[model samples]
Target: MKYLAVLILLVTACKSPTNKKMEPKTYLDIHNEAIVIDTHNDILMKTEDQGVIFDQDLTGQTHSDLERWKTGGLDVQIFSVYCDGNTKNSYAIANRQMDSLDAVVARNPDKIVKVANSKALLKAVEAHKIAAMFGVEGGHMIEGDLNKLEALYNRGARYLSLTHNAAPDWATSAADETTNPDLEEKGLTDFGIQVIKKMNALGMMIDVSHSGEQTFWDVIKLTNKPIIASHSSVYNLASSQRNLKDDQIKAIAKNGGVIMVNFHPNFIDNSFKAKAQAFFERHATEGDSLVKSGMDTWYMQDYLYKKYADEANQIRPPLATLINHIDYIVKLVGIDYVGLGSDFDGINITPQQLDDVTDYPLITKALVERGYSEADIIKILGTNFLRVLDANEIK
Candidate 1:
């Protein structure tokens, strides 16, 4: 009888806290265990702007800092090497961007390390260093030189976004397509085909983020290895020219590529773009004065937006809106084809909750709430990108 009673007690004690709900996995636990990779971040450009080094704390002023990246559990970050089309010396500017990143890695060897390939990337992550890499934001930076492309790859530029908002002589941009619909070449030029082959041969990932639809398809048809939309969102959700259409998203998946959703509220919500447009019209005179004053139009507008932070916040979508883009890509293609490319520092108005680089854990928590398994979240967080990276690595 005593044995029976003890057995009953043991069974009851071990009876699986079924009545008590299993506590959800802490976000920190998930974020810490996962190898988090942000494919696109533009804080490097900000460093160049203010002559401020990333090794120091750049809180409030920028979305990312060295310590903040570490605190955010950023295993790998591909710093964007970008200069708009106006710079006469585009190639020189690109080299200078690379130089800045080199200097940062030189200064903080323990905190971050520049990675040239998947092998080195994994090694840096294993050693608890943020694996730093370069992603040239515009093909114009190469100045139509295959040699320049080769040089960039050698310089640890793992990806080359075919275009920024402005298409070069060799490619067309989404912005150009939308604003002026009568361009001669909507995609890559013949020489541009040569560039694609060169990138493929060098094993550099091709980014179709800011490319026109024709440009996207042309590259999609040519690239041998898997490609990526490094920092684009879904057009269906936001109705922005910058975001990909359903067919494009499927094409990326069919080509074994991944789409790292951008966090721009304008790209995530159409209503936000409308609100932004209205705000811009309201401040048109101030914007022109700021431009005339040699203040960067972006900074002036940012200042105005912050001055109206409450109104701006009202228009800004919630964190769930950003996740919805992720969900759209995951649902349309598959979990293997979607990831996060926050476009932090590059964007002015971020989703409400994602204030800075430190807010990445919220994404994991949101995913858990959305019923994604840990494995699925891992794939979305970084593994999918790593797979694409490994595939594109030079043998």
Candidate 2:
């Protein structure tokens, strides 16, 4: 009887809750342990416009900072090298944006490193440093010169978005495709074909985020390597021209590329547009005053949006809506071709519960709740982008 009691006590102690050594990892653990990457962020453009330092504490004024990026568990980031078409020296201004990022890397050498290839990217991730690279958001910054494109690539730009809101001489943009009536052409020009070939030769991933439908098809017909729609969502879900149609999504998968979905509310939720439009109309006088005071247009909008965040929050889509975009792509193609490209600091608004860089874990948690397997969650988080990056590498 005494030996039986001793054996029972030992068994109970061994089965205690605190004694569980092989317990399953939670969503937070999975998120923190994965190699999370954000393929597009326009914080550099904001920093340049506002004359603010990226490594400094910019809690309220900006959506990203070095420390906040770390807190967000971002293993890699592709900073956007951007300028509007109005700039006379677009190439020089783009270089200045690259210089801004370079300065940030110099200031936070221990926290981040500028990586150009897959090996360096892996090394940065292994060392727990954010791997930084550039996705030149507008091809106009190349100023119709292949030499300038090569120079941007040499400066750590791994991808070149063929257009922004406006088309360059080489390619048409979504804005022109759906809105412009006087447009002479709607696809890539002869030089644009050359640009695609040059990017293929240089091993830079061709990004078609802001490209018009015709431009997208033109590149798809011409490119030798896989491409990336670096920051776009599904048009079926939200009717924005910036969003990809079902045919485009299918084609991207067929061409072996990934679509890193954007988190902007306007792109994720169709209804948010009318609500946002109303909000803008309600604050039109204040917006006019800010612009009249010589503030930048984007800055004035950002100011109004943040100042009236309560009104803004009422219209913001739930985080699940963004996930639904991911889910749609996953179901349309497969898990191998979808990932996150949260357009941080570039858009005026994000989905609810995703306020800034640190809110990334919420996405992981939501994925888990959505019944995605851990393997698929990891792929969606970063591995899919890595696969596309590797596929685009020069062999």
Candidate 3:
């Protein structure tokens, strides 16, 4: 009996814990070891406008700084130079934002390197430096001039997302399709197609994140290289116009492109739209007043957002929902064509539990828990994006 009791104790000791085996290293350890890349981040604007310093540690916000990104194990980050479409001086705004990013890289030469190609990205990683890349967030920033596109590209812009809320006359936004019948036939104008081809020739990535469905299809038909939806989620999950529909997801994969999931609350939760609508309604009159006063919608949005942030949290979706979108895209497109484009600093509210760039490891941990093989997870984290970058690099 004594020997049997001793044997039972030994068996119990040998049994694994109830939880699956996970290393004691914090999520950062896992995240750092991987070549983690976030395809979209709006921290450049935050750093420039809000005086946030990328080289310093961030205390309150979820957006990234160089130190935080390094701590989170982020190897590459494409800083989005986002200017609201309403700005008359969109090109100037874009330039200023780019300059801001340049300044950050200059200040932190030891920590970050501005990279334009796969070789630079790889070199930066080998040197343990953060690869800093640029992406223009809206096509409108080019102000209808293809020359401006070349100039932006020359100035280190690596990708251009085709349009924001206001679609060009030849394209219908997903938001306006329900009310605008004229947009039905308008996908890409001859000029738009020319612009896409120009991008292909220049080796600048064509980002279809905020484009109308017709525009998306048109670009797919025109571009010879892989494209990306820099910061979008699955429409089936959130029912947002900003999210990709099932057909769009499949099409992106078929084109040898990638879809980087967005972490905005409205993009992750279907039910949050009503709350957003109500929030906008309550501030509608004030918003119009601010617009009349010559304040851009982005400024007015920040103002009104502060008033509603607390209430907004009550309806914010869980971070798990963002993962669900990632999972959906992976299942539909396979693991090789998905990545993350967390719209940090650009978004007013994020999903719960994802407060900022520092929270990236949570995703790595979650992906592991979801039965993703480490190899597959690494691809989703950044390799897929690097592959597209390599394929699209201009000679």
Candidate 4:
């Protein structure tokens, strides 16, 4: 009887509630456990244009580096392959950017790997390596050729924004559609519809971040698969042409798509552009000189931002403003449709607290303070984008 009582006590102790796995009690704990994915980053462009070494510690010079990505807990990154509309040999330039990414992965074999589908993405994440993917930022890179589009997909490009700030022959951009009154075409042309169908067929996600209102609607109507706004903010929050309107947000949600919020200050703060116009105007001559000296205008702008850090920092919005954009989307469509897509290395400035990739943990902390549960925070960090990626995969 004494031995039987002792054995029963031992069994009860082994099955105690304390033996269960503990929940993540703090922000870092929660953040480290989640599969954080940033759907849009332009570091490959930076590497190709500036000849900057991405594997080194690029603090203060660039927003991202290979080591810093791991430090920030970023598990997946869709590196943007981009060239402005006017560049000659745009498709070749896009391939050159892809080559740069390939070299990056080649050098850091253990730390990162290129992924073309959801299966490989999850595998890389599980192995504690960053799953790098390609996102062609302009359809103009395809140059109105479907073969070129297929070639990009074959090279591991998973998403392609229909336009940049400038319109392609097949699709109109928000910047041109809104500002170019004399422009004859306002949306996707017949060829643009064909592009959408081809992307759907190839399992490549169609991105509408830079697309005009008409182009966005055309894609929403035509695509049988879910789409992604790779890097854009809320139109109601900031009123930027680059941001998505309320109806667009609703449409995306209804279509089971995801709008990964952009981190550009101008896209997050309503009055940011007006406030920064004078500063940019002051630097316009220097900018033009840099352009004449053969530097691209986008790089020239980023250079100015780096040069006038103190002055530029003055116009950046608070971190809460960015969180407000996320909260707005969550309130409108619930937590399943929104995620992070920091246009790091693409934008010149971020919100005040979000200085670089390392600051991602701050977002998780902010979400926690705002009463978000762990599951919802995980969704916002990466699962929502993962869901869209999976849904768009070729069966």
Candidate 5:
């Protein structure tokens, strides 16, 4: 048996994969060669808040930073320009977030390139630079003006999600449906349809991640190009409003859109929200006191998680759970319609082993161990998003 093991090792010789050799490739080789893309990240929002400088090391502070993106083998990133529903002057906040990204790129021009379309994105990849693009996370940022949408496109935004957790007047959100079930005209309005058409014309992908069922169906019915659930998970596993239902996943596959699985534990694990809810309840008095003192709820949650890191880690799903969501999507659809969209800095809790942006290659290693061929791994990592981007970029 020992001689057989020696013979096996001697036969393979640890060579890289090739046509003639048919030798197994290392996970690092596959990951480095692949055009790794993450379609949803919130580091720009963190930068906007002056929470961390992206060009510097953000270890133990934020999930992403420029140097670490390279360390992580990230080739492309769609920086989400986001604002909550209650934000006053939402458009300005979105623009400010964009400005912060602009500043980061300006300071680190050699490392990152802000790309507007698929062509430019590929060019950046060819130049060995991280392609930075924009994704407006909420429709409310446009302020019901198609011109603002156009402005966002001109500023390098590649997608416009119809809603966030808080739906605007023109469109409903999943949270809206959950809270106001009896409301009439809950779907996309006439103006919302116009916005969709305008996005199509501008070559911006219609993102369905945060939308309600009506809005999702509306985009499927109206958009001329492929849609993207830029960052979401499977509802069957997690049952969160942020996760997609099976029918929605099927609809996206049928429409040739991609469902980029989100890595947020609340959206990835079925028991996460409940356990987290109870944990927060135990600290409700402190949380309420913090909130009353003007601390953001999200910030308070992060603080609590850090304070209870061990318990938090116990509740977080294993890294395999993230892969399981990807596997589920692949089983339901084909390999072409699923991708990675780790919410990273945007997420409160990531599954164990996915500590920061630097952990992306672990996904490649996991996929390889699961028997996904290199070509399939490449498409899942980034080409799926590129296919949709190219399909939308046909202007």
Candidate 6:
């Protein structure tokens, strides 16, 4: 009985602490050390609409406000000057967004610096300031004018997404152009090729996130510099047109381009698409009414998004699904060709776990848990993007 008691005590003492999980330390520590950069964010729209200054601590959104970005250890952010595709005067709207960003930077010059080249970006980083860069969100914002595109670059726009939702007469969109028989595949006209050439010359990264298949290939053929798909996901995973196909991924890799993954739920999760479609179907008539009333696409999307937020919550996937997109791209094109492009204020809904820029550490943690090496994590976090920026900068 004495021996049995001694054996029991030994067993109890040696028992594993199943309830007390070990904290993941190495990856988290490595994440904090890296200079994290997000290639795309749209929080400027909030600053424009609600008179919410990005310099202040904003409460409701899961994006970059001055304090939040600092706490998140975000080194650089490329704010998207996004205007709806359907706008007849998109250039004006783009100008307004750029003005708004300029105002924000002017108001908080100590916290952020507008960077137009790799040198400025590095200087801002060394100064411990958040390097602010611009990426015009749609090609339409240039008004089909190459001069306007050059002017945007001069104004510090680093990249330009080709088109938004609807296909221009010159290029097809990934969204509706493929299915609609009436839609023509204009690919890139001579003017579009010229646009690419000018962008290459101006050192603006040619973006192909929303462009159709033909346009993507056309840009790939025309540009000598490394291109970027600023906010896209893997079509092979979600089977959504908004995501890049395997062949497209290969092409981007061949051109030494990077595909930045978007955080929108529908783009990452197939299940969310059905729910979003149902919500849109229910509001179809109202949406059409708003369109007929000449309501701006931004307002229209905001209205519908507010209406469907509750339903969307039921179907939104976990944020890990977004990381899966990164994993998919890395598998296809190697780790050097992928990065983050969280479309923060541009999209109405994000994945469940990612609430704001502060939640970026979670992505780092997830990548580590997925068996990514520390060196690989650093590359995915921002190093790869910085290399691309250095490679493609005109100066």
Residue 105 displacement in candidate 4 (angstroms): 1.0
TM-score of 6: 0.85
Tens-place lDDT per residue, model 1, 72-138, is 7788898999988766788888888889888889998998998877667766766778898999999
Under the 3 Å rule for N, CA and C atoms, how many clashes does model 5 have?
0
Cα displacement (angstroms), candidate 1, residue 25, comes to 3.0
Question: Which of 5 and 6 is ahead in lDDT?
Answer: 5
Q: Encode model 6's per-residue lDDT on 1-395: one tens digit a residue.
A: 24323432333233222225555546557666566789889886666665677777775643568878877778789999876678788777777788877887898888888987766675676667888888998888898888889888888889988877775555667765566677644578777788888888888898898888878888887888998988999998887777899999998888888888999887888888787778778888998899899886656766777676777566678878988899898887799899888888777777887767888888988998899987788778776777677768755
Clashing pairs in 5: none
For candidate 3, write residues 170-251 as lDDT tens digits.
4556655545765447568888888898999999999998888888889888889999999999988888877899999999
Q: Judging by lDDT, tell me the better candidate of 1 and 2.
A: 2
Candidate RMSDs in order: 8.5, 8.7, 9.5, 7.6, 7.0, 11.1
Q: Candidate 5's residue-wise lDDT over 1-395, tens digit each?
A: 24323432332233223447656668988887778899999987787665577888889899988999999999899999987877889889888889888888999889898987766776777677899999999999999899999999999999998999987889999988777868877779999989988988888999999898888888889988889999999999889976899999999999989999999988888888888998899889988998899888998898788888988888888899899999999998889999998988888788999989999999999999898998889889988888888788745
Scored against the true structure, residue 79 in model 1 reaches a CA lDDT of 90
Clash pairs of candidate 6?
62-355, 62-356
- Would you list the clashing residue pairs of candidate 2? none
| Model 6: lDDT of residue 29 | 71
Q: Give a tens-digit lDDT track for model 4, residues 1-395.
A: 24323432343233223415675468887787777999999988887778888889999989999999999888899999998888889999999999988988999999999998877777777677899899999999999899999999999999999999976889999998899989986888899999999999999999999999999999999999999999999999889997999999999999999999999988999888887788879998998899999987777888888899899888999899999999999999999999999999998888998899999999999999999998899889988898888888875
TM of each candidate vs. truth: 0.92, 0.94, 0.86, 0.92, 0.93, 0.85
Among all windows of 10 consecutive residues in model 5, the one with the lowest summed lDDT is 7-16
Q: lDDT of each prediction vs. the true structure?
A: 0.85, 0.89, 0.80, 0.89, 0.86, 0.78
Between 1 and 5, whose lDDT is larger? 5
Model 4 has a clash total of: 0
- How would you encode candidate 2's per-residue C-alpha lDDT over 1-395 as one tens digit per residue? 24323432343233223425767878877787677889999998887788889899999888899999999888899998888866789999898898888998998889999998876777777667899999999899999999999999999999999999876888999998999989988899899999999999999999999999999999999998889999999999999998999999999999999999999998999999899889999999999998999998888889988999999889989999999999999999999899999999999888989999999999999999999997889789987888788778886
